[model samples]
Target: MPTDPRLTRLDENRVRVNNPHGIGATLFANKEVPVESGAVTELIEMLALQNTARQFAKAAPGSFDHDPEILRVAVTPDFHKARGIPVGTVLATRGYMVPQAIGNDINCGMRLHTTTLRPDDVTARIDDLETAFRHIFFEGGRDIPMTRGQRHAMFTGGLEKMLSETRRVGEGLWPLVRELGVADQLDRVERRGSLPAGRVFGLSDFMGEEGRLSRDGQIGSIGGGNHFVEIQRVEKVLDGTVAHAWGLKSGTVTVMVHTGSVGIGHLCGGHYRDVVRKLHPQQLKHPDNGIFILPEGDRHRAHAESFWDALHNAANFAYANRMFLAVMAAAGMRQVFGDHVGYDLVYDAPHNFMWKEQIDGEEAILHRKGATPARGFDAMAGTPFAYHGEPVLVPGSMGASSFVMVGQGNNESMASASHGAGRMLSRGESMRGFDDEFRKFMEQFRVVTPTDLRRADVRQRPDILNKKLEQIKQEAPFAYKGIGPVVNTLTEAGIARPVVELVPLMTIKG
Candidate 1:
């Protein structure tokens, strides 16, 4: 049988893979399109640059081509012209998987928790809200000044110990929290919502020197990028029943916490990639490009174990990261509402992750790079949200509106959905192109900035793409494929369904 006549090409740095199967794959560059490499110039010349996937396949053709039943490949819009694989390409396979394919930042993601406040409430207390958030969420990252005895209890007793004396804002919040799935999450969450036990051995010692350990506790906290803890209102409820189920109503305000396992996760991911590189060279089926190899002995198993362990650690770090943010946010709300302000965890999940899930009842390692789990079944079988499909939160660019969506249990694309309005341009481009517009957009939000930092912050802060003004030109609200269209695509494709829509009142970027 003539192997599906494989043909490849490069357009600038973008590599295009063409096969009779109609599987046309393109891999992009993280940097801008290159100019004049000096000699050959043609459409085919550009195609010469294989994105990461092609490079991987080229490395170990025997390993990939030998398997017929399982491998599936996908390229997200983030794919750019590049020498290696683009950042967002996704690969799912049964029996074996690659850690680099999923990237080093496992479970690197965004969360958008909502509140019960209305738009009016946001404007009325905007000043107070901003003050509370600045002090509690951003600057309050250090230990909460626990007394010596309290410290002992936290170390010895764990979550229960800390919660017992936590300056919880009010009495009634716990029940509502239970309703939102926080307490239940504590049990069902990986490691019962705790940090991984030991130092990430796989990570390079250099990262250790860079302080990966110090940042572990900060994982549950928000970082820059459009990542934030925003207060939003249900500007529009596309589906009433779903919205109600999500605790979203037009007048109700909510909080959206967007973060992930921070430095620790990146360190873990990088370490695993190194493990793959080391093990690949020893595999029985060597890759064409020498970048990949198919291990025949315990090396394969070792590779798998290393990646899996790193993934678990990173995932737990992310979960703890979000939980801690919730603790801080809950504390601040108690300060103002005194009793009225409240929230229930709609859903806490990560977009960038990998898991061992069954595809057509066959075990497979599914990778969601810049994607979220949009399982169709009500409540993913092993999750707390099993009764309700896991809530999927898709945040828009900074000033743009965000989404509150739910997963449909189908295993399409390995039960995953888009992570966000996927970035069309790199952060570098946004900063260079949309400075003035950003200033205007942020002006509407009332975030007080220091004089020195204001200019520096505006010097092309790509993070502000969520703001309307900066978003206007490049990532303008119009630049991104509309959230409505994406949601519609998900529903049409049976990947996910929209539950509610959230518009930001104020946003904070790292």
Candidate 2:
């Protein structure tokens, strides 16, 4: 079999793939680690997927058939085929925004917290902490201090609006916020723990729609599928200067929460996606009918505003979701240990989302699916941690050590970094028994999961129990690419610099 001529190795850290159909879709991949043949095929498929976006290009920006709406597509080192398109793929476009590139889970991301507690403090009560986590994960991460109206405001605006609404209606989330001092933690959050808030983005299409203010119950929950809350130890500070700025030190305990907007995100993303599909249903023909582009929209009225508000609404909800979850996790730790075992949110960033950003003089929408923004100091000029650059948290697979890196703000990457070690295998293909190897692998750290209790304590059909166990095994460490190479690629590409190395001391998953 001859090699695909379109795929060319540009350099040790770059693989260039020219679009076969001459749509000018090019894929540049990181070659710091082994680039899998399967991933390359998936990347090619992603280019073909853009066929739908290309057609909708109102005025092409460069040389292309439809006036260049689809500008460039770059594959991150952690690239892998996902639900339909490839994850870790950065799709940049001018004049239009493709919804598929951001994914169904809006603002799905990780929130990292630097704790005052020492690793030894958590280790001393590891068993009790595990029990508390079992409750936290399975019990929907505890009750959030939010009301019906506040929940609606949170989705519409974000944590900032939610807090104000809470005050207007009652004493607000300040009780808990002041008690835990989590409100101040917003300084370290991306966008201050909220999306662009207020009526400045305008009202939603379903303005007076009844039951619109729902989802109060889901405010603090961690939606399933690769989502987790891990208590980790800062094993090493890779960059002393950056680490000092980010307040990271050796032996410090940190909690990382990864999740999305829960039901709200899904509803908003789906509703707007369907709206786009219905605009021209026949035009949605492609690998997944997944490529739909929204042009420079009026965030002030009608369908465009609906789409804009809905996307931001979901993003806002996701920000609050991760914030509420982090607070809940900190509370749980305080309960198991003591109030002195405190933690402060270090950084919160979303991977699965899209935003209109200006690259050079051209305005384009950067869609980051399973990728994090790696903006450098210039991009974060006014921020408190601007000196150290953006905190890009890369979570490793279950039982694997994760990383904390600072974005180098490389423009070639569209200021993005890999979300995690790209999945080497899909969930279905990686399913297997939780045999001796699986047990030993997880035993290294205290992992509290519902399956652990369900398998041993509860009685069920053998087939049913086995099925449950297999689902958990699909997320095993072996299912992912080695984190070492992925992080190395980030640094080598000049997209980011590794700062802190964190090893999981305890993990909780749905």
- What lDDT does the true structure give each of the candidates? 0.52, 0.72
Candidate 2 clashes between residue pairs 3 or more apart in a chain or in different chains = 60-67, 60-68
Off by over 4 Å in 2: 1-5, 21-38, 48-54, 57-68, 167-174, 197-215, 281-290, 297-301, 432-436, 451-456, 459-465
lDDT: which candidate is best?
A: 2
lDDT of 1 by residue, 179-258 (tens): 45565445434334343323334434322232112232343356645466666778778778777765678867777776
TM-score of each: 0.70, 0.88
Which stretches of model 1 miss by more than 4 angstroms? 1-70, 75-88, 112-114, 141-181, 187-220, 282-297, 378-388, 446-481
| 387-448 per-residue lDDT for model 2 (tens digits) | 87899999999889899999988887888999998788778767654367677875565666
Superposition error at 318 for model 2 (Å)? 0.5
Q: Show how many residue pairs clash in every candidate, following the order shown.
A: 51, 2
| Candidate 2 global lDDT | 0.72
